[model samples]
Target: MMVPDRVEIDAAGDAVLAADQAAALLGVALPAFLADLRAGVVFSIVERGEGADAGTLRLTLRRRGTERRLVVDAATGRVIAAEGG
Candidate 1:
């Protein structure tokens, strides 16, 4: 018997998160993050698809303008934040 350590889904049902997801996470009151992406302000970890379609990254925008990803056991992604002084 073999156990799979990581599982990746490439179906249409679960498409990779895009910049739009960033906007929603940021909770743009009147759409502010839109310009950020175009200006390369927002950071991301792009995971290219098999072929033809690619360059999608799973990210959650932050007020700091630079959010660092962490690994945790919880379902809802949570990262330890630092107090910006």
Candidate 2:
């Protein structure tokens, strides 16, 4: 799959906020977050549940062959969930 450029993702407004929140939760800087996003990270916007207008941003990152996922609430910029470290 083709990963989006930072500018393209940032253009959506909420994407950048979600990325920033996820990065902060992981204790990383914005540049590092963007770099990771560029380096085969998987990102998507998903609805919280049925009837939920706002969605969460899901990010999957791999490091040293270990993959982890972070779910960030787009409306509040909060990390709602994390998996696999």
Candidate 3:
């Protein structure tokens, strides 16, 4: 029951894209995306708010050593995006 027991991996919204689509949106290799996912550097979250007032989580990845940079929002634990260099 770690990932909502299957439900956790599901997205309730319509705008949400599938894994392949997400990778295309991010313009990254599939292996790289998987790496980010395994590193807990990829995620999504919806903030409680009206319309357009909700804050979004953004992840900026950078190559430091054996891992990447996972930038996230302070309020929500969602990752917006990631990069590898």
Which structure among the candidates has the greatest lDDT? 2
Identify the leading candidate in terms of TM-score: 2
**Candidate 3 stretches greater than 4 Å from native:** 1-15, 47-85
Sort order, lDDT high to low: 2, 3, 1
Model 2 lDDT per residue over 1-85, tens place: 1222221134453444356655554556778867877885634443343245346666565433445555665555555666664
lDDT of 1: 0.37
Q: After superposition, how far is residue 25 of candidate 3 from its true place, in Å?
A: 1.0
Q: After superposition, how far is residue 21 of candidate 3 from its true place, in Å?
A: 0.9
- For all predicted structures, in order, the TM-scores are 0.36, 0.42, 0.38
Which stretches of model 2 miss by more than 4 angstroms? 1-11, 14-54
Q: How far is candidate 3 from the true structure (C-alpha RMSD, Å)?
A: 10.6
lDDT of 3 by residue, 1-85 (tens): 0111011122433123345544544556668877887887776543333345354333333221332333333344444444443
* lDDT value for model 3: 0.40
Which run of 10 residues does model 3 get worst, by summed lDDT?
1-10
Stretches of candidate 1 exceeding 4 Å from the true structure = 1-15, 46-85
RMSD of 2: 8.1
